[model samples]
Target: DKRIVDWTNAQNEWKRREIVLKYIASKGDEHELYALILDNRFVHHHRSVTQVRMDLNIAERTFNRMQEKALWEAARIIPANVLVEK
Candidate 1:
């Protein structure tokens, strides 16, 4: 039962990550969107939000807004179980 639970957790995590990445990739030519992914460490190596802000040359408020928007978009696009293959 423990093993099954662990496996289920792993699968869920993978699915969540996949959905977020797909959402990010769908937004074409939005540097802020891509930068949010990098800042959040969704892909590639992780970096501090401060570093991401500096690298993207965006202010703190802007970075926070972008992060919030990216998360909102990902949440909006995540499919209900009825729409996903078992």
Candidate 2:
């Protein structure tokens, strides 16, 4: 427990989102794409899937694939114990 870094305030989802951004940024070249999609979908929560696809000029299928990849990577970054299922 002492080793795990948990600076995010659980009551404030935005803090967790910031941690997610930092973790994603620490990744490789793919981080940009992952960051963009994840930021819009989860971090910012202002852009819809269609808006992202339009902004990127990618087809729905491609967007879906990228979104899936982003989610998978984000899932790996966050600790399992910290995540609560509804």
Residue pairs of candidate 2 with colliding backbone atoms: none
Of the candidates shown, which would achieve the greatest lDDT relative to the real structure? 2
What TM-score does candidate 2 get on C-alpha atoms? 0.72
RMSD of each: 5.6, 6.1
What would the per-residue lDDT of candidate 2 be over residues 1-86, giving only the tens digit for each residue?
63343433544566776788778977877787788888887666768999988997879999999899888888887777655577
Error of 2 at 71 (Å): 0.5
Q: Which stretches of candidate 1 lie over 4 Å from their true place?
A: 31-47, 80-86
Predicted candidate 1 versus true structure: per-residue lDDT over 1-86, tens digit per residue: 99999899778866676656666776776744653554355445577788777877879998878777776666566556413443
* Candidate 1 clashing pairs, residues 3+ apart or interchain: none
Model 2, poorest ten-residue lDDT window?
Answer: 2-11
Model 2 off-target regions past 4 Å? Answer: 1-12, 81-86
In candidate 1 the C-alpha lDDT for residue 20 amounts to: 62
What's each prediction's clash count?
Answer: 0, 0
